[model samples]
Each structure stands twice: as C-alpha cells, then as structure tokens.
Target: MANTNWAGNIEYFPTDFHQPSSTEEVQDLVSRATSVKVIGTRHSFNHIGSPTEVFISSRNLSRVVSIDRIEGSVWVQAGITYGELSLVLDSEGLALKNMASLPHISVGGAIATATHGSGFQNQCLSSQALALKFVLADGSLLEVDKHADPELFQACVVHLGAIGALVEVKLALVPRFEIAQSVFLNVKFESAVNQLMEILSLGYSVSLFTQWKGDCLDQIWVKRLPSEPSPDRFLNGIGASKAQQKVHPILDVDPVNCTDQLDIPGPSFDRLPHFKFDFTPSHGEELQSEYLIPQPYAQDALRALHAHQSAFDKHLLISEIRTIAADSALMSPFCAVDAMGIHFTWKKDWHSVKAILPLVESVLSQYQPKPHWGKLWAMKPKQVAQSYPGLSEFKKTIQKYDPNKKFQNPFLKELFED
Candidate 1:
C-alpha cells in the first residue's frame, strides 16, 4: 500500500520511495532513475509529490550544515523542518524573520510552494533564500545565488519541484526576538469587512479565523513583537475581546497542540507559528486550499467569499485570512504584489470539497487569484499559466535544468502541457 499525505486526502501511486542519507546517494539515485519526484514529510494535500517510478524522501538527509554568524545566514539540508531549524537558531540567539503557521513542513517543501506566515511586511518563505543547491535531472550538482543568477534563481526557488531536487538551501537569518500571542474573540464580521486592511495590520503578525456560519469572526490571533505594544482589550469597538484562556485555531478542538496564548511571551519560533512543534496542528483529518489575491482587491474578495457563506459553510471546518508582503520570486503567488491569502481548511470529504472548489474559483476568477502551489485546487493549466506573469520564463528555466524532463511528473505535465 502507498502512503497517504499528512491530511490523508491523497494516496500516492505505488512506487519505490528512496531515503537517501547523503548528497552523493541522492545524486546516484536520481542519475539511475527513469523518473523521480522529491518529497518532504508528505505534508502536501495533493498529488504534487506522486511519482511514476521512484520518489526521493529527504528525511534522513536532514542536517544543519552551517550557520554563518558574520553573514547572518544558515545553510541547512532541504529535508530539515522549520521547527528543527528554529530550535537550532534559537540556541545560538538567531532566528528567521518569519515562519509558516505550521512548523512541521520541510524547508524545501515550504519554499517550493511559497508558504508564508501572517504579516504585511513578511514575504513568503522563498524570499528568505539567499542560495540553493540542486541535483539536476542529469545528475549534475548546480548551485545558484540570487545576486549571480537572478532570473534562474527566482524561477528555481518556487519551481514546484519541476526542475530538480533541491538538496540544500541557504537562508537569511535575523537576531532572535521575543513575542506574545493573544486571541481576540467575537470580532464583528462587519468590522473586519469594513476595516479589512487595518485589521490585518493590527499586529506584527495576525490571523483572523471564521467558519462562515456566524455574523462575527470566531477568533482573531495576534502575535506581537516585543517592540509592538498590544492593546489591553483589543478590537472592543468591533465587539472583540481578548480571550481569557488559550484557544485553538479550529474551535472545539483541544488547544493542547497550539502555542501559548493569552499574551504569554516566548521565542520567535514558538509565537510566530499558530501550532506548537511538539503537537499536531489543526485537525488531522482535513483538506486545505488557499488563494492569493492582490491587496487592492482584498475587500472585494472578502465580500465575494462572504456572499457564498451558505454554500461554503457545510463543507468548511474553518477559514483564515493572512497577508504576505510582495516578493520577486518568479512563481510565488505574491510575486511583486503584496497580497492576502484566504485559506480554507475543509472536512475530510474530498468529494464535497472538490464539488465546491469550482464555485469558489468561479466567484474569485475576476480577481485573478493565484492558487497556492502545494494545496488542492481545481484550476486548469491554462488558468494557472496565465495567472503568473513569469510562467513562460519559469518554464524555460525548468527546461534548461531538466532538458530531458526526467524530473517531470503527471502534475507538472498537466500544468505545463501547452
């Protein structure tokens, strides 16, 4: 039997999964394989990691290769999870500027999908890449940095694993800092609707959660840096009051897996992510989908989603709204445009979620929303190709790195099949 994804929504096709313990071993396996796909921790919700013949698992390859204090950067194996990296950095009094809501995802997988945290000024994870090392389709090790190979690096950083296997990554780091997380409850939907941008800018990092069944938001999670003072009782004007107790992002679920809330101060790694590293985040049985729309259309997008509350409520478990700063990565959803990501965490029934996505896409179509690369979506190849201005150039870069298409998979074929 093949393994299912972390959400258990996707059952990978039957194939040999390789666990290479070293760079030389990874190169050897790729050189001999007829087809290959690189996977990390199986956290994806779709068949993006499926392989025709062989799949490379980087779990055993994880290692913190170096930490350059002078350069303020860290070089880590692609398989290492952000949580692992964070702990190492914290011990040295260093940190990454931002982290995704879930810390379990591998560094390479997150960067490949342009995963992001909630902050108007914090760019997606890929933006932290100073350099990367890939084992190309032809078994050649290629290294590129942003300054020396801007166009190729931009395209390669978020290539969706279409170019090659990213074996190592160098990321920019910052001085470690402390943060406090607080949850505000029952903020009127109207207030969030009216002051959407202002509400998003309320903290160093903010996340608004709802289930679309009520007139008000279920919770508003705010993570503030030490320098940013949080209001004593926030969003009171909108009927939102700080939660007296810790709460999970999904209501009714135990908050044991979540980070410390109620304004308890902790390290950046602990507060930046919604879930704690020691416990599973969100419900284990769920499917996720997210769309990134430019900030200019945020209000319109919010209204559009709200209008379909009735239709979406039945299939949805929870939804979150987050903001990401603009970036220059070629295929990132927020490429060159600061944007908002409207994320949906749905019940385990794939059929219902699949049926409803077209409706969701149709309504948000006018906004030219970019579907997150790693999540489930019903978008067509033409629609995806047209959404990114740099798609053509990105395709060219993929071809240059993998002329024989050894890295190609069914998913890539469907998206790039012009």
Candidate 2:
C-alpha cells in the first residue's frame, strides 16, 4: 500500500494498517488495536485524522447496502468515493445535491471534514447524510440518524474519524439532474469582488480561480441547469468573454483531465465536478489550506488577500474562491452560517508554506476564519475552540462513546487537549 496520502505529502502507512473485508472484521480488528484511526481514500492534505498508533481502513467495505428511492436515500459502505457513488446513484435516477470539485474523495472523509461544493443553496456533502453507522472502540455498532438521534447525528456527522470507524452511511438523495458547464475568461477582479455573490449565484454552482497577482480573475467556471440564463452581466465586464474552449483551472495545466465545458450540458455527476472521474489525477504534488469566513466578511477577506498577493504569488499554484451554504453539523466550519471558502493549492514547499501559512492566518484573523480540518492550518488551539463553540462539547460527546481514546490522533489531540 502507498505510504503517503493522495497529495504524497504525509507519510501514513502505520505498522498495522488493517484492511478488513467486512464490518465484522473491522469490529474485530478495531477491538484489538490499542489505539486506532479510521482512514478512507487518504485525501486529506494534513495529518488531522491520519493514524496515531494503529489504523483501520474501510477500503474493502465498498458496497451498496441498500437504496430507498421512496425516502430519497441510499445506504452504502463508508469506503465508497463520491465518483463511485455518483455513477451508481445517477443510473438509478437519483443524485447527490452537491459534491466537492474533486469526486475521487471518499464520502466518509469528505463528510468527516465537512468538505463542500460551490453553490448559494447547497450545503456541504456532510449534510446529505440521513444516517450513519459506526463501529465503536469496543467493536460495538452505533447508528445515528438525523430524525431519531438529532444531537448525536449533528455531533458525529462531522466525526473526523476520531470517535469510531465509520462503516456505513445512508445519504439523502435528489432526482437526477443535468448541468450545463461554461467558463468565462479574464473577469475583472474589481467587478468580481464588488458583485461576488451575484456572480456566484449566477449558476447552481460557481467557482473563481486565480493566482492572486493579476487584475483579472484567471477564470470563472459556472455549472448551471440548462434552463438558467447565461452570465450576461459578467460578460459585459471589460476584457471578459466566455471561454471558447474547455480550460483547466491551473493556467498552464492540460485541460484533458477536466470536465466538459463551453456550455455543453452533461450528467450532473460529470459536469458538477471539475475533473473527470476516470482520469488518474496528474495534479502533481501539491499542498492545500483553506479558510471559511462568514458571508458578511467575504468581500473584505478577498480584498485582504488582494493586498497580500505577493505572499502567495511565488509558491501558489492556484486559488479557488467559492461559497457554501450553512449546515447543521455541529463541528462543521460553516455550521449555521453561510461562508465563503478561500482555498489555496500551494506548490509542495512545506518550508515556504509552513512559514507563510501563519502570515496568511494573521491576515484573515479579523474575519474569525475557520480552517478546513483536512487541510493545512496554523490557528492556535484556543482559537479553534473559539471558532467552533461546540468543539468542546463535541470532544466530550465523542469521549463518552470512545472512552479509551482509541481513535485519537496528534492533530486532533493538539486542538482538543487541555
């Protein structure tokens, strides 16, 4: 098995990385491990939920357990990725409400971190779960549902793979829909930020990509329902025009791996995501960090970023700005407040990144930004606790279920420790 994560940054092949074929096997393996952490797809850029002592993976547990079309939900093993789930759900005339830009990430990992897709109305992928089933530290199963166990559900839905090894999830679904994809070139930075929400709301999903040094945004990708209007007001901007060809988010990379664009309509599964599911990501080695600020402060935050363009210009590969709707997940960064995510995909230079990240955090401090759990962050532990008011309650709740702290990791330990 690969020693490092998807980004090839964190080396995490534990002495005992168990890949159990069934939930019972997971139970037995987890019960024997003195300490453990649950990993799925290993997509996280940081070591937040990576193994601390022993590790158990749901890799072999990928299977569709059941589908409740009547209730608009489908149950599946936690190992399944959004790419895999989308193909299955779309074929059955159902679909996910939203998905992160990259679909190869496991649904379990995405939710655990409250990872989101772009949209004015759609919440993070975690909110789609109607219920989840986990194998506790003692090899016992604990199932929580949104309707029946609301408090427990809110706490565990963003579990961070700490309380237990999640084995299965029942996700809420929507009727299958199509999205027409388009990209606008060189949108003015002034107009973009001045009317940020307006442009973002132009589509069911919208994303602005840039390198932070230019007067114009590199590109504005929009995924809209076919019946929606084109972004005419945006095109009216000086030097802005709709992309004549499909383009990659990174200015110099190949577009062959990206989804179909140029206003072509395709399955929501295909168009909603930036990359094609089948392509082995040649994204090359990269590191990521994100900050989620409350909606009211987003414009000011962007202007702050604009002031510090020099901080990122040399090492930054690209940055994606997007908006996510608020969700009820207790530990979610966007919990109960609509937020704008400012994500930076930096070149693999931890020496530079490690030094510069604190500076970036300092700039966004006024906004009280909440960093993504799976990405790089430099916020103080006390600040993290303050950002998520329920984090202390969350730690207590999970500790009640995982008394021995078998699933604890150093990343989580630092934040929650007294």
Candidate 3:
C-alpha cells in the first residue's frame, strides 16, 4: 500500500485502493463500498481520508475538462496538483489568485480544508471555487454552484471529506501577473508587526516567519504589484545601509532541496504560492497547529505566544504568521472574518503538542479562533459552532448531501455528532 503525503505522518493499510478513471467509476465505488473515504494527494495532516474497508483516489482522473477565457474560469478534475495547474495557467496568462505553501498539494485536498496563503488582499482558495461536482454516497452525481443549491456550494467548499466524493471543480481565474519578493531580516518583533500591516496594505501579500526565540523577528517576505518599483523605499530609508544589503546568504538558498536558489521573474504562479525554500529539513518530525483569529487580535495573540517563548522554544522549529481576507466557505478557519493565522511547527513531539494545545486554545479563545480543518485541533463541537457563524446553516446543508454519515471518519463523527 502506497503511503499518503509528503509528511508520511498519517497512514493506513486499506482493504482496497481504487483509482477511478471516470465519474461513473467513482459513483460505482461509492455505491458498492460498505465504508469508504476519498483520498486526494493525501496532503492532509489528519486522517480525514482514512477508511478501513475502501479508499478511493482521483489521481488518475486528472484532466482539464474545459477552460473559458471569456468567463475567466477553468474546469478540472479534482485530483490535479497545484504545480500542474500553475504550469497550465502560465501558458494561458491566467492563474489562481492565491495558493498554500506547497504546490505539490492536490487542488481538491486544498479546497477541502479551505487551504490558503499569506495575503491580506487574497481570499482563501475555496472562495475562488465557482462550482463543484460530487459523487454522493448513494452513487448519485450532484452539481452545486452559487445559483444551484447555494448552501451546499458553501458547505462543500470546505467539506473536510464529510460531504461526498469530489469529481470536478470549477475555479475562477485571474489575469496572470508577476510579483517581486524581498526578504528582510533582524527586524524587531514589534516593529515587524507594524511593518507587516504596512507591507500588506501596499503589497499583494506578506508573510512573517520567526523562530519564536524572542531574539529577533527574523525574515519578512513581501510581494507587491509588479508595477511598483522601489516598493521598499521607505523601509530602505529607515535601514538604508542594510535595506539594500541582503542579510543571510542562506536566504537565497532553497531550504528544502538546498540546490536551487530562490529567484523568479515572470509569472505570479512562479513567484507567489509556496516559497521555493523549505526552512526546516532536519528539524525532525513536526506537528502543526494553526488557529485563525480575527485580524484585530493578531497583536494580542502574538503577545501571548511571545510571553511563553521559553516553553514554546523548547519544542518549536518556528511559528509563522499569515493573513487572509475573509471568506464565506463554511468550514474555513477564517470564514467570514479577515483573519490572522498563527501556526506552530512543533518539534516532532506529538505528546508535547498534545499537552500544550489546550493552553494554546484557551489563550486564543478570547478572539474566537477557528481551527484549521486538516490540522490538529482541540476545540469541541460547541466551540466549533461558536467560532463559525454559519455552522447551523452548513450542518443543514451537509444533511442534505450526506445524511447517513457515510463520508464521516472518527474525527468528523466527533465534531458533527451531538
């Protein structure tokens, strides 16, 4: 049995692994399996796709069914990877407005959890989904869009594998453009936060990566409109001698493969999405926990985390802060709130992460944080309901699509059940 995902952290030996070549095949599998779950690239950190009796994958179903330049949309099989889509869209002068940290992740997998990137101006990837075609548990095909079954469209946008088997997705596209990124290092933490807001207001996207050691803020990556030359003029003025000078030679080195350098000049797809660098390779196995608190609470959350730096640094490789414009997708962590995401990449200590999660949750609870669907979370159903304003409406829609709970896993069962 092939394992799932890059992390290879979550795996199971399924009774059967079925790769469906067509929509009919998917329907048939769903109809026949006593218990089944769909898998897409297996990028999810959780076991949402785990099933004992049967596991279905859409990897072989990948195909660009249609592209409408006039409508600025593309219809593609759900299994296509963001890396593949980036190349396709590059050729046509079109691209997705935003994407997560990795291009290897499947589009379906990303949309399932409302995967997003660091961009105050950009919405979660799910918000770009115009329509979805799913194979229900009963072997019936259902098409949902804004105009047809709007509630289902919203719910299925971030279904967490509890709705149905996704077949095809219709995504809105943007005119492809170029972005220039410059990294700043050694900025003060408080000053960096202020600069982050400024960069976000002026740029298309901005990200803050820190080691949580309380020494320095480390690096800031800012992507702005291609037209803006001297985008960092003010930043340069403040630290003119250092502004023009690149900090670490290590900054240019790609953290992952360590061979490729981080430089891109042409399309947004190549420039934005995931950083070409992977910073933590030998940091050992790691557990991730991210919470989306309203943008207003960003400083408060950062302060709380900083206060616990001694404890946090004991097991953390880094903690990243990113922002996303509010979205309407039902299960999205930042649903309907302009959110600031605080993510912790803890040193492969699952026990440590498990131990500290409740404390972390309590600290952010004042801001009404919503947990990322695919990551480790400590919130109960009541807390989840309180976090998402449209919870009742979303649950009602799920009932219409998967009333019998055939799509549920142990995790989801606990969340959706009383």
Candidate 4:
C-alpha cells in the first residue's frame, strides 16, 4: 500500500503488490513473478528493495514458527518485527543481545541490512542469526546456517534482499535481563569526542545525540545493567550534568514517545531501544544517512564533521554517534573491524541534503567510511565497491542461490556485476 520509504524521499510504485500470509503463498508469488523484491516495514531510506516486476509485502507473514529453549534459539517468520518478537521472547523469559533505536523494523529486514544497536561490543543484528530460510527463485525452500554452509550462511545473513525472499529467521537468544537508562545533558563536544570510547563503554548500550550547531553534545544516553554505578558527571565532573527529566533525541519534540529514563529499571524489551514499539514514527518529513569507520578513527573523524557545523545545522534535525563491534557477516560494514557509527537525520530538504552530502563524504573519506546499507549515501558505485571488500564473494553466493536472478532489483544491480 505504501509506495515510498519511511522518509518519503524515494517513491517506489511497484507494478504488483502481494501480501503473502504464509511461506506457501510467498513461494507461489515468487514462482509466478518474472522478478520480485520483498519489503518489510519500508523503513529503509534507500530504494534498495524496490521491485520492478513484483513487490511482496511481509505484513501478513508475521508469526513465530518454533522455539528451542535448550539451544537458546527461536525461529520466527520474516515479517515479525523486533517489537512483536520482543513480546514473545519476554513470555519465554529470553531476550536479544541488542536492538536498534527503533524496534518497529521487521526482523528479516533488519538482518538483511545488518542494522545494529549502539554498544562498544554488540555486533549488528545479523550476527544473531543461527539460521535463515528463504524461498528461492523457483519457489523452492532453501535453508542455510553456520553448520550447514558457513560461507553461504555468512553471505545471506546480510544479503541486502538479493539472495531470495527471506521467509524465516532463526535468532540466538539470551536470558531476559533488566537495564536502567540514564541521560546526561550538554556534554562538551570536544572532550566527549576525545573520550568517545570510554563514554560508549559506560553502558551495555549507549548513544550520543547532538545538534552540530552547538558547542555541546545534546545528550548522552546510557543503557546499563541495574547493578552498574551511576555517574554524577563526566570529564572530571565539568562537561555535563545529569538530565533532570526524560528527553527526546530530537530538538523540542515530546519525550512521551521515548522510553523511560533517569535510572529507572525496565524489561530489556522496553529499555534497550529508544522508543516503544506500539507507536510508529511520524514520517515523510525526514531523511537519514550514516557511516561506519574503524573505532580508532572516531575522534578524528568526528572533528572533521564539526568543520561543517554550519552546513549541518542548516539542514539537520539531529545526529547520533554510536559504536558497533565487528560482525562475521561478509557484507556488514563492521565486518573487518569494530566501528563507530555517525548517523545524520536530515530535515526533508533532499535538495540541500543532496548538495551537502558530497562535502560530508569528502570530510569522512579519509577514514574509509562505509555507508549503512539501509540509509542514504552519496558514494558512487565504485566507491561503495572499494568500501566493502566482501562484495565480490557476496555476489558469487547470491548468484549461486538465485541463478535466474528473480530476486534482483535495480539498486543491487548497479553495485553488482552479472
């Protein structure tokens, strides 16, 4: 039903939209179509999965297929969102290691793009997959996991919607745990950048939100275990003060949409992510872009961004910086090294955002930044190729799985060779 991405910057009006209720239906649709692409929540800022011949929506496919308590794993239909799965996991007294700021995204889509949560050690969501099930080009089911086919497993985990339509995801789980979220206001941007790694390590998951126009970082969100000690200040108790009240990541928005904060302990499902899943984001007004470079370069890379504070301030709504550990998935940006994610949420002025992106990329180019596959980036196809060394192998894996190329789309076609 929705033709555009959540940001509404790119309009994708597919010729055919099919909502398949079960794997059988998905297989039927795929077999009948000449070409196809699958869409989850349509949260992606890019046109990565926009289909030319057919569009398959995962809306009706949300369900839990099985659970393995002894093995600590769960098999969920591709359409189930992290939020929905969280509820099921909570009942089972299990939890995921991390979650993105927004839990509204479907599990398959999140893993496909290697979406990650903020933490010094947490890998992207794709790393949690024990196995994945896809309906391939010929309406035949194919499954891959670490044990079955390590190479193909690694390749398809973050397949970018190319290998096939991901029908199911088998995710690893942990015992459910409680976390307390705290916020610090007005941290000195310079000092914060200097001790970026230390700040990120303060919690199980942490995020830094900023408005580049100012000298201070807007907020530092820390999600720590209940037993962890709280800090009164940072930079020898001079840079920031604890937030007296809950605050939204954006400037002047209502904090009601945000999760509980100020040292309140809550279930992992509630505290790990920034917002509650029941409420969908108000959209069509913003666009986002992100880059992940090695963690060692974070401080210097951040300094390079400040030089364009004026440009960022004019077109930006908010920006966040987070850390991600290296993942085994071949195509993941953080595959080779631990990374620091620099994210930009720009106001819906695509013209200005478009014009200013080259400048942003130029500043970050020295760090060998890798763009978030789900978000916007100005890098040319060749530059993207250079950024991810695993692309060639990834291409080979997909080509093997979908020999007919029924799952291919224009976005993937540009970067990959036949």
For all predicted structures, in order, the TM-scores are 0.97, 0.98, 0.91, 0.97
lDDT of 2 by residue, 113-232 (tens): 998999999899999999999999999999999999898899889988877889999999999999999888887788888888888898999999999877778888889999998875
| Better model by TM-score: candidate 3 vs candidate 4 | 4
For model 1, residues 16-109, the per-residue Cα lDDT tens digits are 8888988899899998988998888778888777888888888887899999999999999999999999999999999999999889999989
Per-candidate local distance difference test? 0.87, 0.87, 0.74, 0.88
* TM-score, predicted candidate 1 vs. hidden true structure: 0.97
lDDT of 3: 0.74
Each model's Cα RMSD: 1.4, 1.3, 3.2, 1.3
Stretches of candidate 2 off by over 4 Å are: 237-239
Q: lDDT: which is higher, 2 or 3?
A: 2
> On a 0 to 100 scale, what is the lDDT of residue 54 in model 1?
82
In candidate 2, residue 279 scores what lDDT?
89
Model 3 C-alpha lDDT per residue in residues 97-180, reported as the tens digit of each score: 887766667788888888888887788888889999889889999888865777667777887877889999999998888776
Rank candidates, lDDT, best first.
4, 1, 2, 3
Model 4, span 24-100: residue lDDT tens: 99999998989999999989988897889899999888998999999999999999999999999998899998999
- Evaluated against the true structure, the overall lDDT of model 1 is 0.87
